[model samples]
Target: MKETPIIAAGLHDTRSLAQRIRGQALRMVTRAKASHIGSALSIADIVAVLYGRALRVSPAAPRHPERDRFILSKGHACVAIYAALAETGFIDGSLLETYGADGSMLMAHISHKVPGAEFSTGALGHGLPFGTGKAMAAKLRGESWRTVVLTSDGEWGEGSNWEAALFAAHHGLDNLVCIIDYNKLQSLKSVDETLRLEPLHSKFEAFGWAVREVDGHDHEALTKLLEGSPWEAGKPMMLIAHTIKGKGVSFMENKVEWHYRNPTPELLDAALAEIEGACGNA
Candidate 1:
């Protein structure tokens, strides 16, 4: 394993951390010629906030019994969380170089084998159900820890997600929180073209969840909302984070092609430069 510089910063540095996540994911996808760079970019800030301030987890004690659980339902965007894990010390940054290579734990999709990843979820609709079960278990065990599941806007098409929503509400699982990365783009087209999820907030409300919407890139708002989950007692929290696809990279923003398009070598250089310039060389 090759040793690389790690950014071992505290909570206050989440903005910089988000930039690093984007830069890291960009490079990883570029190296492997993998897909879903856009998906990963869309949720970079959200993931950064989760690891930086919201999650009650420790890299040194990744499997601590009392730690909060976070599941990424949009597992195709694994690079973002992988980057977060590396940056925050849950795993060595060097392992990132092996990403998408043969037999690496860092699969294209998120996997539980990776440190700090609570669940392995590549199939669209499984994350919420699994996370809901975990939340229910916590409630039954009288544990104070919370369960957070981040799903893609496009994933709302999965009937299983709705089933999990109803189950969570029926059980009054306030400790459960679900965040949607509403980037409005899916694998090959706009989410509206693929499947309309309008009145998304109202849909969650009907399912008995406490709903809130925010700009996904706003670090302050994201941290505040995520850290202060379960906005209402006896209700699951549904936060719809409206975000732009392919965020941070000038050429890729909101362009659906990026969903399956890996950045070319020249594009990778430009993307890294933009990300590093935005966050600085520090």
Candidate 2:
């Protein structure tokens, strides 16, 4: 097994981390004959940044009360999150080899049963409320911990999400932060064609939360956004992270067909090559 690097080395740029994890996730899914490659790729950078630099977790003590919480609302992309957890030393990296396999802890959806996962999530529009409840609990206990939820753009169509949005705003849960992976592509078609969520930033703002839009792939922007609180004193924060589906993969980018395709060996090799090149350049 490769040794985990020191967190302070400053060698692990979020983009490189995302690329590395995405490569691992690709291998995991391909070997398992699983799907959701595009969805996993879409949020890789954000997950990389969160687990690599922002999250407060202990690999040895994942249930530490003071630790920050991360809920993957877009749980179909658990491959990316699992890869991030492995890279961060929260789980044995080799365990990723069994991803999606029968009897494997690494399922296709997020599971709190995993060492680093804070909540079990897969159903769309469920994470916000769950994260809100956690944030509220922290506030009640006067803890400094924060709750962050990574949501999919397509999840905006769910009424449950809007209900949670309104509830979070009403309570002014400042410790809660929501990051939307705005890749603009859903399972069967483009988000615009399936259900237009245009003017997404405005929608969040109108709901009484603070809003910021940024390039989801840009690590620096993501780092800054994660570090700072943007919502009003009593409001929850929302970040509309503009991203590309199947980002960093040449043939998969913006191609909806890749959304559910298990990567063939040839495609996996090509994807790894691209990630290797990016890591080398970085």
Candidate 3:
């Protein structure tokens, strides 16, 4: 499919935005002495594309009715989403420093208290169903708004996800889009070893969703897939975004240990350097 002119024009800027968010997320996690840095990095690009290019969100009026809805199913990775929201002007960037702090609005997981965030989610398997309900509501109201759900490959183990998947297909909620961060590694081990969700694409197809697999870190590809509406009529869409767990950092990429390890000051500096290099190249 040809790139829409609007999407093409924003591709570089969106990538730069994502890279910046990744850097900020890394710094936030490091400063907070928290974990999930790897998961946060894994979905940075996807979050950027959603907020920067695709999602119809109002910074000044985040609750705008016609606006699209986004649910971060893997809420542990919400640092990236929060960074994107701040960068997009939906919230204050200064608030990022308080992430995970006591009594802070930004918790370790997502919270609806944050403007632009549609739903608060940390428990796995909840986001997909919530998004499905939102999409169904939109459909019932004859609204054109879309609902996008972002989940990790690891979350597939939850039976709730499958139930929602089946429900969405049965209801033919065409406006719903599910993006899977297939970064290979989960918390304990690789996704393959954890549950063996191989042939993931076919599984979605079997559930009656139109499926497309793409490089999660490729901004242009993500933009095209999202904008193109690869799904058929009367079907939901699923994009399996194959990605690296710790994408931008050299030593952290594909390393399972980073899943729950807080980056040291030196490591944080190195990761920021890598992100800066990526920005320059973009």
The lDDT values for all models are 0.91, 0.86, 0.89
Cα deviation of 65, candidate 1, in Å: 0.8
lDDT of 1 by residue, 196-253 (tens): 9998989889989999999999988988898854799999999999999999998999
TM-score of each model, in listed order: 0.95, 0.94, 0.94
Alpha-carbon lDDT of model 1:
0.91
Query: For residues 72-117, could you state the per-residue lDDT of candidate 3 as single tens digits?
Result: 9999998999999899888999999999999999999999999989
Winner on TM-score between 2 and 3 is 3
Q: State each candidate's clash count.
A: 0, 1, 0
Off by over 4 Å in 2: 1-12, 228-231
lDDT of 3 at 241: 96
**Residue-wise lDDT of candidate 2 within 1-282, one digit each (tens)?**
754432231235677688878898889889988888888888998888887777766665577676788999999899998998888778999999989888999888999989979888888989988999999898888888889999999998999899989988988888999999999988889898999998888888899998989999999888888874544688899989999998888888999988778888988898999878877887
Reference-based lDDT, residue 150, model 2: 94
Query: lDDT value for candidate 2?
Result: 0.86
Identify the runs in model 1 with alpha carbons over 4 angstroms from their true place. Answer: 1-12
